[model samples]
Target chain A: METREMTCINCPLGCLLTVTKDNGKVTVTGNTCPRGEDYGIKEMTDPRRTVTSTVRVKNGSAVKVPVKTKTDIPKDKIFEVMDVIRKAEVKPPVHIGDIIVDDIAGTGVPLVATKDVE
Target chain B: MYCRETDVVIIGGGPAGLAAALAVKAAGVESVLILERDTQLGGILNQCIHNGFGLHTFKEELTGPEYAARFIKRVLDEKIEYMLETMVVDLKSDRTVVAMNRKEGLFSIKAGAVVLAMGCRERPRGALGIPGFRPAGIFTAGTAQRFVNVEGIMPGSEVVILGSGDIGLIMARRMTLEGAHVKLVAELMPYSGGLKRNIAQCLNDYNIPLKLSHTVVDIKGKERVEGVTIAEVDERLKPIPGTEEFYPCDTLLLSCGLIPENELSGSAGVALSPVTGGAVVDNTLETSIPGVFACGNVLHVHDLVDYVSEEAENAGRGAAEYVKGQKAGIVPEDDTVMEMKAGKGVRYTVPAKIRPATVKKDVLVRFRVDNNYKDVSIGVFYDGRLERSVKKRTVAPGEMEELRIRKEELDKYPEVKEITIGFVE
Candidate 1:
């Protein structure tokens, strides 16, 4: 039996959640929303987070352009994803939602520009 | 001096100015001008490269720049006239705006209506007044953000942040992602000033400790930051005698608070609210100076930029109405004004006054609470009597609260002079 206390990041109203796992069965308490229970379950299994970072820009108006993963990636893969992003560079006319890196760090998630760098 | 005329002149070319310009054009006002001091149009949003913006306005999560780009695109598509790198130095209550740019040395604009959307500035280290040696590595979170996200320069390798504001929290994660070790986050108040989700994603995700009720009492270093000494505070917010702990770091980030940029509004003789540090506005967002309107962070600090856009749109529509009303010779009566007051458990409310007749459909009253509350009911009182109350699961000072009063609601109580919003047991 294992128990862990955490705050649900699903919404602004962060509900303090108590997740109890006993023999593969997980029970979440103190959650106001069902998403909190899902979060608790996901935390017990595989934690995921949407990573946002700045990629260097070449010949763009700004020196760097902000980019984010298309979807949430495994939490443990953040450093690897950042490593790929740090080395990546792009040119001007980069629009928002433009793919900067495909299959970033083997996460199968493409990194998209969050800002226009023109 | 070069001179021009416009129906409305909006100060600042950020999200507020962009949205206001679009709204003004939508209201059939042709001559609208936006003055931006920055070389670009997006203002601070260009530097804020994080996602989680525009959930309300765009109905989807967007980064700060992306959110601003949407409105910027709209303003451009609408063919709104705007001047970049043009600073509005002086604004008169008579709608005379003195501005300057590289191309135009000095110029004046006769505006029928003006919108104040100067935004806000981060509180500096000098404002906090911690006893410390002058150091080089100390930077406000926003400045550091501009350095890293915009200029592609790392401020430091190690950081100790003071204040649990959203900027500080975001920077903690940002610095960490860039290989900097964020030691800890110390906040003065027992409760965090940032959103709860930030605490979870920014701090908790990185295993950064958030020490609430703790503050930096001393900063140690000569030319560069060496360390910071944090101490736990008592109920009165005074540091305890022996609760000092030293943290060795290369940088100390300050995310204390934000102050509304209202110097131009003040110079224009707009009535300023002591609590909000912004202009005292009516329901139409018109300042006491009549034709001048205020919105966005220049009106009050907002956690969400979507609200800033929404509020600025209201100000824009109001400015458009003012310009059209003047041409039609339609004047509003002063007797229809209703005063708004903040009762117990509420800190302050925006739109300090409301003219029931001027409110088109609904009057949106936004406010902040004095402290944290659980399972509380927010009561809207009319002349000291509870007229409407809504139950809230939780309310905190960090999150802004809003209550909408329909035009018919005010018509029911015609004799009511004052409306107060507060927490009820």
Candidate 2:
């Protein structure tokens, strides 16, 4: 059995949450919302975070267009995903939601443009 | 000089200006113009490429540009007119705007109402009074953000951030992702001025240490920043002797604070609030000058852009009403005006005055705290009588808190002379 205390990142309230893992069963307490419980469980299991960064743009008004993962990626892969983002480049007239990279860093999460570059 | 007439003239093209223009057009104002000094719309959001914006307004986490595009699309679809690369040189108390552009040498607009949404600027190194030599690697956090995010240029390979402001926190993560080593982030205050999420996601996740109650005492470099000397400060913020620590870094980023860009407001003879560094406004966001309205960071620095949009809408609607009132020749009769005083632990409140007669439904009073408190209750008092009290588990100076007072509630306190907001232990 293991227990961990952490702050909920779901919202600004930042409710303090305690997660206890006993006999492979996880129980979360001190959460004001269900999302907080889910967050606590995820933290104890597999942590994920949405990555936001800029990629170089070619012949666009902006030198770099901002991009983000379609969904949250594993926490341990943040730097690796950033490495892939740092090396990736896109051309002008990129619209929001345009896919920048597919299956980035083997995370099965595609990188999508968050801003239009024209 | 070319002359034009407009029902409403917004003095900026940032989020505040864009939202205000959209609101004015929606309110049936035919002639509305936005003046932007930048070559593009969206202001600083263009450089803030990070996510976590529009969580409240859009109900989804969005990057700055994505959030801005939503509003920019509305402005375009509404056929609102805006001039890029144009700057409003002067704003007069009589609602006259003198503006300049490359194509139009000099132009003047006679406006029925003017909305001052000029926003705010970062406090620079000169304002901090840190003993330092003018160096190339030292930059304001926003300026560094612009350089790195927009221009694709790295400011330095090694960095030391001087404040834990949101911008500084974001930049700490950004610089690290860009392959720069951020040694540490030193904040002068004991409590961080940034949102808690930022501290967790940006610094704690990245393993960067945050030194609270610490400040940079000296900058060591002649041309480019070579390093900085940091020291701990007492409760009074005076640096204690013999606590100096040195970190070797090429760049020093200052995210100390933001100041309301009110030079135009000052020249326009608007009444300014010493505490907020913005304008003294009434419930309708009307400045001392009748039809001139102020919102967004120009009124008070907001922690979220969503609040800025909301506040700008109020200013826009107020301007529209002012224009209508002028055309109808119905000058508002002076009604019951109550001053809002900040009591203990409260810093200052927006809409310094509340005119019950002018408010249609409710008035939202936004304020901040001087220090951090845990498990405290916020008391809203009317003439020494408690009107409402809200219990908060934790409140920090970084986040702006708001309280809504309905017009109906004010009616119950008809003889209310003053409204005071304070902290109850």
Candidate 3:
């Protein structure tokens, strides 16, 4: 069993949290709000974060309007996910929140809009 | 005058207003109206093409437009009435908003409670005290974003962002991808004012240089921005003499900071907090005025849109409760009051004053520090007398920290008249 001290990043409070793991089970404590609890579990069991960056665009003066995965992806697959996003090209007249990738790398994190581009 | 009478009237049809209206409906008060100045319901979010919102409440990453669409759809589904192209020119003391728009020359609405969510405005070059002749190339970050995202216009080929705030950082990456040569992102502060992720993804990933402890001392141009003089600053914030350098750029994008849109609130005769330059409110988010509530960017600059939604909902719920006669206003029972000051290394704390009745156990006292301090203890004092201390491994002035004193712990401090929060090494 191993123990870790972390801060919950879900809210502005930045609550000091403790997470303990034995075998494969995880336990989290010391969060003030519900969002903190969710963040703690995600941090302990399966940490995932939505990746946002730019992608190659077609037929536009500006290259990017910022794009991000719609869902959280596994911690390790971020670079692989970006490679795919960088290679893919979206035609102009894209509205904000238009889904680019439904399930990127099968991580279930859909690539979505960050800014509108036309 | 076409007067729309309602219990609560909200201004600015953004996510804040949408959330506020939804919260009002959830609280069992339905006579709510949201007035928008734009042709559509969504405000700035329509142009904010980036993702980074709706992570907490929705548990999914959504673009600005997508996030606003969710609430706007919900507001429509709930039958929340709103007016488009409605610009409120005058708000009266009796809670009436007088507006003039294209379709209608004049209209009025009498509201029992008002939620001001006008959001904020970006700081421009003039606000930064940069010595320069007025030129055509200088633009605020928001204007640049709108030009690029909405109108599909490239503001410039060479860009130098004046502030390392989120907007500036985001623009740096944007201009680069747009085939523009972005020279640098200059910031007056040593540390970035934007989120850590923004600094990483926007600048670092793009190899865009970030110049810290720097300032644009002078701007030189005739018809358009030709070049700018940059200088390094000392601890006192005065530009050092020999550290002056010049960078040639056709465009200067200022993302210095954001100011709360509090003109209407000021006109309403509401008390303002000098620290945040926003309306002061109790726990209920109600302004000093009997039935006026303020939230979102109009109240204070928020780091995340999620917090803005949460606060706007609080204001909406509070307004609903007030209109329903569910909440009774009263002078705090404990006549004793303590003036809370952000002692050394602290920027400011909200409310500024605390009453025993309004002080709750687990009170979330949010305050910012003046500098980054490692191994610091936040000390709470009662009128110069030490009460309690919470130790922190690391704390920064850029980030707001909240310290909680349980109701049980608060009960012990009976003689407390005023509380002061400060940091020490």
| Highest-scoring model, TM-score | 2
- The candidate maximizing DockQ is 1
Whose DockQ is higher: candidate 2's or candidate 3's? 2
How well does each candidate superpose onto the true structure, as a TM-score? 0.96, 0.98, 0.79
Q: Per-residue CA lDDT of candidate 3, range B153-181, in tens? A: 88999888898877888788767756788
Range of the 10 consecutive residues with the lowest summed lDDT in candidate 3 chain A: A6-15
Q: Can you list the residue pairs that collide in candidate 3?
A: A70-A110, A114-B49, A114-B50, A114-B51, A115-B49, A115-B50, A116-B49, B338-B417, B338-B418
lDDT of 1 by residue, A10-112 (tens): 6666788999999999999989988899999998878898899999888878898899999999999999999999999898889889999999999999999
- Our model 1 lands, by Cα RMSD against the true structure, at 1.7
Tell me the lDDT of model 3 at B383: 69
Clashing pairs in 2: none
Alpha-carbon deviation at B405 in model 3, angstroms = 5.4
What are the DockQ scores of the candidates, in order? Answer: 0.74, 0.67, 0.14
Off by over 4 Å in 2: none
lDDT of 3 at B188: 90
At residue B149, candidate 2 shows an lDDT of 87
